[model samples]
Target: MAEITVDLIKELRERTGIGMGDCKKALVAAGGDIETAITNLRKAGMASAVKKEGRATNEGQIGFFEAKDCIALVEVNAETDFVVKNDRFQQFLTHVAEQAADTKPESLEAFLKQSYAKEKGMTVDEYRASIVQTIGENIQVKRLSIFPKKANHSYGIYTHLGGKICVVVDLEGASDEEKLAKDIAMHVAAASPLYVNAEQVPESVIEHEKEIVKSQIAGKPENVKDKIISGKIQAYCKENCLVEQPYIRDDKLTVAQFVAAKGKEEGKNLKVVSFIRWDVGQ
Candidate 1:
């Protein structure tokens, strides 16, 4: 039997775009013959996924999974909307989300290398490769997020438009907890606010908005300009900050004001601790 060196595995993986583990297995099975290994990978349908890796993946679905103390969000992308509806694709998303919910890996790279939750012996990357083979389309797990609940916080998630947009909100203390958290998630899905609060807005973004506002009022005096710019900045913050934005359910009250009112009534802290919004392909 020929020795299957690391060089052989590397070459096979480069040629086939199959995972390192599968490439090594193919090489060993083929007695270290690169051509034979390639043939074996092709026969197993694993090689097709590599070729399709460059295809544009603008359509897909967002999956949510929650356990007793952890919540996860996963976005998997495919080349077309038709594939999004495929049971295989949906199953793959579920598997990925479950893995995310279970492991809570710090990064996507780590998640890819972590052991798959449902498939006992394979890594997530390997499982994804198998699905790519089965689906006959390039499938990419674009992002995975895991948020473990804090002792003082409760979480809520909302998916709208069949997973086109998903929102996850973390709130301080559990006061009117379920309804408040859910309504906040719904507001995030609809309004698409960019930051949790004014503090989260970047200084560079504020400066950019200031420049645009200044340009719009080019002829104004310096003092008047300063006042106008300050007001514009406040308005911008209100528009972009989740807590400051007018609540979708009732525009008369800002989200922060609504939460504060509810908190006072319920006798608990109700601050928006943090949130994440995922819009497919964005």
Candidate 2:
């Protein structure tokens, strides 16, 4: 057997964070080769597909950006929240967000594959690897979103806790009241709007709502079916439309009236095109 020194055990333990005894055993098994031992330990640690590097990067920060008509958000995850706040990780996230804003990739996967502008030396994954080595833990690029501009539109973006949560909104047209767009975006971050407009409500959700309404009105006579249908449709419209939502600031005027009032005052028609919201856990 090769010599198993205390130094070997300590080094392996520090590298893998596995138990000291386990690290020592791995070293001996690898015939005092630290590299071989680390590989073996890492392989054993790979309990799940994602665990190969460590774990699903359950911790990280969100990154956000906006430029006139375009906006983007990215989530860069690391093994720990401590690393999430590290200057390097934060800078990396900013770089990734900027890259996301700059690239008009046809798809999210395509976006990840694109060379990250901030890291000239490597592709996105390779940059992540460099960070992982420096940080001594697994890091992952989770997901991102990029919004394309619409004619005459402006984008509003919100970031909380350096990216614990993010929200972006696209106003179909610009207004002198730019603050309103931000307010709307903040509301989305707080309230978590699922659909931009009633028309965008998924058919599955609508059908599910209809079923629930139908069940509730089941005991009613068949003669009132039309009335029930009409009432349910009205409820659906009121519940699903962001325009009909109670204004977050005032809680009095519906979102439609809120926008309309501002539009009139500004002498512009501001329609909402779409929005995106992201939170760490979600």
Best by lDDT: 1
Which runs of model 1 end up more than 4 angstroms from their true locations? Answer: 1-14, 19-25
Candidate 1 per-residue C-alpha lDDT over 1-282 given as tens digits, one digit per residue, 9 for 90 to 100 = 688988888988888877788788888889888999898778766788788888899999999998877899999999999999999889889888987887888999999988887888878877887888887888899988888877867787899999989998989977238668888999999998999899999999999999999999999899999999999999999989999999988999999899888898978768898999999998
lDDT of 1 at 159: 93
lDDT of 2 by residue, 111-159 (tens): 7667768767456755665667666778788888777666666667787
TM-score of 1: 0.91
Cα-based TM-score, every candidate = 0.91, 0.75
Instruction: Kindly give the stretch of ten consecutive residues in candidate 2 with the minimal lDDT sum.
Output: 43-52
